[model samples]
Target: MSVEIRRVQSKKEKKSFIKFAWKVYRKDSELKKYWVPPVVADYMKTLDKEKYPLYDHADIALFTAWKNGRIAGTIAAVENRRHNEIHKDKTGFWGFFECINDQDVANALFDSASQWLKAKGLDAMRGPVSPSMNDQCGMLVKGFDSSPVFLMLYNPPYYNNLVTNAGHKIGQELLAWYIDQDLIDIKRLSRIAQHVMKREQLSIRTINMKDFDNEAAKIRDIYNRSWEKNWGFVPMTDKEFDFMAKSMKQVAKEHFIYFVEDKEGRPIGFSLTLPDMNIPLKHVNGNPFTPWGLLKFWWYGRNISAFRTIVMGVLPEYRNKGIDSILNAQISEYGGKHGLYSSEMSWVLKSNEAMSKLAKVIGGIPYKEYVIYEKEL
Candidate 1:
């Protein structure tokens, strides 16, 4: 029973790759509880080059490893042009990776993905970034005790061995801080926030859903400016940003997204906390649209008591003026007001000291850790 790696070429093969994770998780019931199944159709859109706009700026190859006629693993190799253009680094990525506990299976999959990127002239390979860093990136290296909030990934504890066995070293660590709403010192943070707000004449507001396009334009401005210098960052194209904004609207609550502005009405910072959809999504089997699935989705959704702060950033010049504290305090206050008990401000880069300090200041626990691995291609 030798394992073999094959390229995903035909449509049927693509389908096989999309569905292979279930097989990997099916073998581990413990993993299954933490692993939320993605909607079959949603994954299809990600793999379909003509459909996913990301392919517009990225070159990619998909591969699967098989053993005894069963799918043992899957991976995607990607070369994002925008990343190289922005960072001036010839680095590629491997993501959407899933495999059995066997290091051999993991090696085969990595070998295939690496070879493909090497051929593309990429100097190094790094990731668990399914395609690009803007999306779901990083492999869960800690916090295996609980299920990941929606859009955050979950993997078995042993998966760490697969990367090291494949000769990859940790390239970076990403943190997901668990904030117990009841535990944060909001009163203290609030005092700081008020001081900063009054001194800077800063005011906070939520997205204007009535004029969403206009609102999105403001967010786009802050996002591009705030995160331009962050590691592995590439600003999303106008088309990409608009597409994301439109899609997010489907699940958005106006109160959950915030904007902080100066007295002159310049948007200086933003934070987006998506309600933890995983609670409901888990029951819906990943697709929220099937008749019964939608019913289950809404039913479970009403009981959602948490959120994940997907992204939060401030313009570089405004970094030390308590903007981060304001964001944390506001999020804590909002969650408590709404009767939410828990939230996660996640995927924070380990190198980001400001965020680490803010997490500490707000009583956030680094409960989940995700990592990016790298190797010379």
Candidate 2:
């Protein structure tokens, strides 16, 4: 059967594009474990020409693959100004990708994205980045044992084959580690960390929520400096950072967000963790706007069992000085005190062996894995 690819046009078509995953994964028991039903209204808002800030500086196209007049797959093509400005490259991104095991459908989606990017004069296309890599930007290649943690991508195993068969090569790989509370070597690390701290005059402390702006500024500086050498790294704009900070204000635990400062009070490193909202989000099937879903979320949020270590970074000069162990020890200490049992230190790059090894040293299990694929266009 031939698959026809067309840009999402009407409201109904947009709905079909966003909700196609539900139909594709409906009968698959494995897909149901951590499936978060995409909130159609909220997703559409992101693509709106008037509302989304990215729309102001980017060209976007949403395409749905149709077979026999029904949506079979979907993908979104974006040429983002922010990405271009940071990388100084005319590269485009393909995101929100989903499809059946059929090569025709995958080809249809890829062809549409390529044509759209070419029209924009982009030199190359790289993604599975739904809008941006700062968000979900990968396909699962290994470690598919459990449902994805909060904000991580989950897909069928065949998705990787489909992507590679479509000619996409490995662009980058992100790692996810599961930390079991029962097996942590916190006492050993704590003793070592104490010595390291005393020798280096380094101390770990929680960020002052009252002085969040000052703290955020320090984080911004450290993030830009620490991750500047990473592949596809972009210095987040002020608006982006502020937007994230505002969102974090609601769910961020004061103790879970920590900073390591030098003897002279310079911010040397930081780690940010959030209660794994996926537990409750899984119950709601991904939507939390309804009164019942909101109630369940509120109820479950108060008693979250797992936390996600979303961001952790140390300055270049501070690396390999046991600063990471100090940060991890602080997180484990706080988790023990707060009744949080387990944590997920995730989306680490596959090439980031140092961090991955450190995660294991702190008793984090390699549980989940996500992959990013690319194709030259």
Model 2: lowest-lDDT 10 consecutive positions: 33-42
Task: Please report how far candidate 1 places residue 305 from its true position, in Å.
Answer: 0.8
Off by over 4 Å in 1: none
Q: Which candidate number has the best lDDT? A: 1
- What's model 2's overall lDDT? 0.82
lDDT of 1 by residue, 309-359 (tens): 999879989988889777777888888788999989888999998888888
lDDT of 2 by residue, 130-169 (tens): 7776666788878776777777777888888888888988
CA-lDDT, candidates in order: 0.87, 0.82
Give me the displacement of residue 237 in model 1, in angstroms: 0.8
RMSD of each: 1.3, 2.0
